[model samples]
Target: MVENINIRVANLQENYLIAKHLYLMWQDIGVPDESIQSNWLEITKEYIDNARHKLFYQAFIADISNTIVGSVSCKIFAGLYPNIIKPEYRKQGYIWGVYVEPDYRRQGIAKKLMEEAIAYLKSISCTKVILHASPQGKPLYSHLGFDENNEMGLDLS
Candidate 1:
């Protein structure tokens, strides 16, 4: 059946489902190993819940048949690079947790969710929008004006 899928702002009420989807996405990206499954689930839940309260922007969820099949969130922060570099801080946002069900792939769902995230970030006066895109999503983000940059990472363990 061709059902109507609606993309709307995710509320705190949907935190669990959102967290579940995020956990699945992380597994899909090879970031969460089998040994970390339980720990990661708790971490994802707590983080998703906290972002709902702390972030200035909203998370978007695409619901089809009352199931959240796609999700994306933008984080907006008012600060310079690390905020210690300069006192004059501008707003920045990031698109994250972008996922669509396997069966729902290539159906323009991810594009729609990303459009929502971009629009929301822009509405919040975000000067930049960043995301660590998966290989499958790189082309989509590139087509939408996101480019590759030499990004560095640090592991604080």
Candidate 2:
């Protein structure tokens, strides 16, 4: 539990920082450098911009005395199937790009960011929040009340 850390919503101009953090997150998850696009930052920024404008996308950052140390992004979940359910019961929020500076790990910054995201989703009447958690993030997310989802994946390579 780190003291004096500030968690706040990210501003529009800070999308690039959020994008960079996402790229770093990929690397941290052992994505080969060659597997990521060279222009990943631009692509991610574009996605964030579009999502922000259209899908209620929001991002949060953790700062320690004015220096950013972590970030998380969330938005309305674009479902894979056709949606017929009412918004009040089936509206889902998605969370992604959760990252923390290596030096700041284990200090509760990530938990704070997650709690903030969950609050935002709840405020919008989201019935559930979803994320594909990396192995490293599973414990923290589990502790935050997230449950195992019904999603399945297959290797297409």
Candidate with the greatest lDDT versus the true structure: 2
Which tens-of-lDDT digit does each residue in 1-157 have in candidate 1? 2348899998877767767777778788787466456676678777766665787757888888787788887776543346553313456687888888888878888888999999988887777788888888899999899988888779998
Show the lowest summed lDDT stretch of 10 residues, model 2.
144-153
Off by over 4 Å in 2: none
TM-score of each: 0.82, 0.98
For all candidates in order, the CA lDDT equals 0.78, 0.94
Q: Which pairs clash inside model 2?
A: none
Cα lDDT tens digits, model 2, 58-143, are 99999999999999999999898998999987999999999999999998999999999999999989999999999999999999
Query: What alpha-carbon RMSD in Å does predicted model 2 have with respect to the real structure?
Result: 0.8
Each prediction's RMSD to truth: 3.3, 0.8
Best-matching candidate per TM-score: 2
Candidate 1: where are CA atoms >4 Å away? 1-3, 31-37, 77-81, 84-89, 153-157
